[model samples]
Target: MTAALHGLLTGLTLIIAIGSQNVFVLRQGLRREHVLAVVLVCLASDVVLISAGASGLGALLRAAPQVVAAARWAGVAFLLGYAVLAARRALRGDGGGMEADARGTRTGRGAAVLTALALTWLNPHVYLDTVLLLGSVAASHGEQARLFALGAIGGSALWFTALGFGARRLGTFLRRPRAWRILDGAVAVTMLLVAGMLAAG
Candidate 1:
């Protein structure tokens, strides 16, 4: 029971941080576009990563200094690039392009699924949280590792479901272009802050 609670708390702490993916998810949730697919992808990715961590890969990651260093630099570069793009959009005050293009109507579902997958899988922080941090914590539980993993996965599902579905309440308010601009600016600042944290660590 204690392990389960610990896992739940750890998962919540790691997942609650703001990042590009969260920004994308929030935007999609507000738009009410492909929300189910987005939630599933996010939750599934978390499950896979947390499971891998529980299986002892977390210890392996911790021992590998070079790999962690490489991931840090790569993550830094990605965040920096994302921040610049967001800043550019903010400066242009162009929130109009945030919507899906009309030309790809037929493939919208597939595209949304793939975008969610890529967003979850391609982000290095996901691995850091699930495969390393959560993994290491679960490893200490010994016989309780499986229970801890379950709790972590449950926490992730709960968070994404609430975040994606609950965001719909803001849909009416987010319809304004000014709202988009503000969101984009917020995203830009978040990206830069995350990058600074990663680089500093």
Candidate 2:
């Protein structure tokens, strides 16, 4: 239970930030175009990635103490760097708000699914966050690693569900720079804490 909760929070903090994939999801939601398809694709992709990380990839790392140590430090460095970037975004209000893309003709379901797939699979950050960072963190839970991954998966489920289905209601607030500043500030703090925890371990 504890490990799961920790993973849930970690997943939320890592994923809640503004990014291309998220932006795409948000836009699809706002447009109300093949939202189910997009959301499903994203959720499926996450399941595969997170499962791989917590299982097969994690098993590989557990066999190598030196590799795990190096990866841990690397994760710490990455999280800290990300924290700094998020802090800058919070302070400077740069890349702070979602832009309103001009509404065009509704895209087909297949096209939307393809786009979601590309956004998720083709993005390097997704691999780093889901496979590497998340896997390392889950491994720290020891025997409860699967539970941790489950919780993280839950987080993704909740986030995508809310973001995709509730975009209409959230559109106005999400467009505000202040809202983004607050979100980014929280992200910065979360990243710092996660980085600290990894470093201590």
Instruction: Give the number of the best model, judged by TM-score.
Output: 1
Tens digit of lDDT per residue, candidate 2, span 1-201? Answer: 999998889888777852645766776786567888898899999888888888857556446657556656766676677678768978976533344234233467897798677656644456667877899899889999999999999988999998899986865666776776776687678767766766887
- Pairs with backbone N, CA or C atoms under 3 Å apart (clashes), candidate 2: none
Please report the TM-score between candidate 1 and the true structure: 0.81
Overlapping backbone residue pairs in candidate 2 total: 0
* RMSD to true structure for each model, in Å: 3.2, 8.5
For candidate 1, the per-residue lDDT at 167 reads 91
Off by over 4 Å in 1: 96-124
TM-score of 2: 0.63
Candidate 2 achieves a global lDDT of 0.74
